[model samples]
Target chain A: MPLARRIIPCLDIKNGRVVKNVNFHHGTWDAGDPVELAAMYDRQGGDEVVFLDINASWEQRSATLDILTRAAEQVFIPLTIGGGVTAVEHVRSYLRAGADKVSINTGAVKDPDLINQSAEIFGSSTIVIAIDMKRRPTGGWEVYLQGGRTPTGIDGLKWAEEAWRRGAGELLVTSMDADGTRNGYDMELHQALANLVDIPVIASGGAGTLDHIAEVLTTGKADAALVASIFHSGQYTVDDAKQYLAAKGVPVRR
Target chain B: MAARIVIVDYDMGNLQSVRNAFKAVGYQAEISPDPASVLHADGIVLPGMGAFGNGMRKLAERDLIDPILEFATGGRPVLGICLGMQLLFEYGEEYGGGPGLGLLTGRATRLPDTVKLPQIGWNLVEPVAAAHPIFEGLDQPYYAYFDHSYAAADVAPADVAAVTDYGRVFPSVVARRNIIGIQFHPEKSSRVGLQMLTNFGRIVCHSRSTLR
Candidate 1:
């Protein structure tokens, strides 16, 4: 009846290798080979896998693309590649390399029209605008860029609306405050963004337990949850997460 | 000889994944824009992404329309995926209306406004025909990855092989004779999807033997 909420295991890749970070920076560790890890996730019944090229210089970006080409060969489920994608050509290259979708973070914030242009050429569904949000010292949240290092004065809620109007198919919102904390997702952030945009919102950051996932998908109203450390550390398999969700009455593909 | 499967390439999105999926199932498919290759293939897979109008225009530009149309009627398992599936219909209401291949008796219309556009993610595909070969070994109401805003609406009831609900029940899989159109990406739908592709491969092999 209803569309199943997606559980996407995000592979934060550095130099063509999978890595996990704390709060988008500290306590980084190598996970494994990107292609092998992706295939493993697919076998484990992951709904989708994201390869975020975390320090994607030109050489590393090419390396990531090579990984995607190889990963697409084995991983039969959807694969989304993100990070350091600034131009339309980058989007084209990723898709050609077999990425189902290309996510743009800083690229979108710098040139909001990149959303309009890429969505026009490649169709909206292929363009995912990843927004990294941090709670401002004041009350609301501000959008961050450059792997959540630079804070933009733009309001996170307003920027999401702009991206949607520009024809972004989905929003991958990562909470800088909650990321790597292993506490929970920023429910307030996800609930607000999901309510503002009609497009699908993927809630990222701080998923310690199954209840946190259930909370986000139900009360948070997110269409998908992007998980990293839990699955990476062998603490939980994607199937384990889905089973827990299904037991808790969350509609996950089992 | 191995089944001469040709995936029509008219500059649509990544066809490598589709070919890889076939390879994973012990089949090799050639990606070609040549109409002659398409006409000669034992099976044809029309894979596409992006807008429907652009897809049709690209097909027309490459002089592939007639060959594909001919292949559809000539039998031998013609499969269309996503936008390729939409193009098999008579008309598409996307990008301000355009003519399709008219291989099936329906039009691609936008999903109801009740749901989000580009209903991206996995949804349950309930087999309407119950015995279609493409659904062999698949659990009924299996989860398949779908990503599109427009789907084949007003399809003939008998031609509908499966249906999935987003905003409303739309034709997720439609089949008539040797031609099959699937709105979901079986290549990206994991094992359930791979099973469908494997079944399609079997259908192609059986059809070839039948012709001989």
Candidate 2:
């Protein structure tokens, strides 16, 4: 089956609030009540919702899902919870709690085997591999894990292909260099990875407007584009985003 | 005064919009974690998202399980949203092995790999039964938003109310007795979506007067 294009709204939760971090820097960034934030996205026609907890620890991770639970309680939409997920058991717990799927980054790379085990345990369709990439002049994009702090040295396209082979059902590629820049998605990175595998790729970082979303899907050939800063700051609603995509001849829930 | 309706809180999410949706139709909704509020409600909405095991754990942790089960079984009108709908089943594939409220006689399973795990977007919803009161005035194949990998098919065919296709056919709305559930967000589906909520609100007001 072809992967459906997604209009996902992301919430970076910290201390029960929706937040966003730039350049992977840890400053006290705060967005208001998570429940209210999620509800706004739902009303605006967001397809899927993601809550990435900036507080990366075992106990703090549970708080993220709790926020997801609280938001899920109000918004009848698909929820994907990430952060501090290090094992297959964590994936099961999140999915059962109400998350349609679970996303992993540092954990999957720290232990490359986690992807295989998670896919085997919960099925590949339930697992999403989130990749943070930085432009490496040596030639291909280099993979960044650990919230864009650690470098994996592996070329993104190769790793993405291996991830799908390892049982990851989808890929979420975030361009660390362009993240929060509002310039645009890394077209070079997106183009190289789009055709390398059958799994859908969620273009993350550098989305400033509806046109950027359209550009990524049309030019970059991605199935979905993950937007944070644009939607989080109220620059646009998911409905407006969908309208723009639909106008551009892209399939969206309008 | 219209029939009084209350949302089961238990510190569960979605109270604001559910309240907002009800308010949009000129009705006020109260978010109460109180068991008495649920028991006395003329129409009740139980909304959920997130994981089933933790939600059930929270229900048990907050001592809300029996109260919710009691209200649904006692014939007070109750509507379960998303995960709330999933919890009504006998069990879920999540958390390895956990028991549900058993309000509906079936288990919920994650959609297999052949279909996208989380079927996201404004896909079409088709009513299988001949337009029940809950579905009054709703356009067939109207679009509603969905976000989840697990769905209900294990329920008896008689209980199924609506079905939507997403690489595979699955139950989107199910009703039995006074219970009803919509997998898509009626509150988020724009005009058609809002109309469904308006219909639900009217159902709450007409079926009971305490909601006013």
Candidate 1 per-residue lDDT, tens place, A11-58, comes to: 988887899989776778888999999999999999999999987464
The clash count of every prediction, one per candidate, is: 0, 19
TM-score of each: 0.97, 0.65
**Interface RMSD of predicted model 1:** 0.9
Query: TM-score: which candidate is best?
Result: 1
Q: Write the per-residue lDDT of candidate 2 for residues B25-137, one digit (tens) a residue.
A: 67788888887788787888878765678778888887888888888877767788877888888998876858888898787777777754566556777888746777888
lDDT of 1 by residue, B179-209 (tens): 9999999999999989989998999999988
Best by DockQ: 1
Best by lDDT: 1
Interface CA RMSD, all predictions: 0.9, 6.3
CA-only RMSD, every prediction: 1.3, 6.9
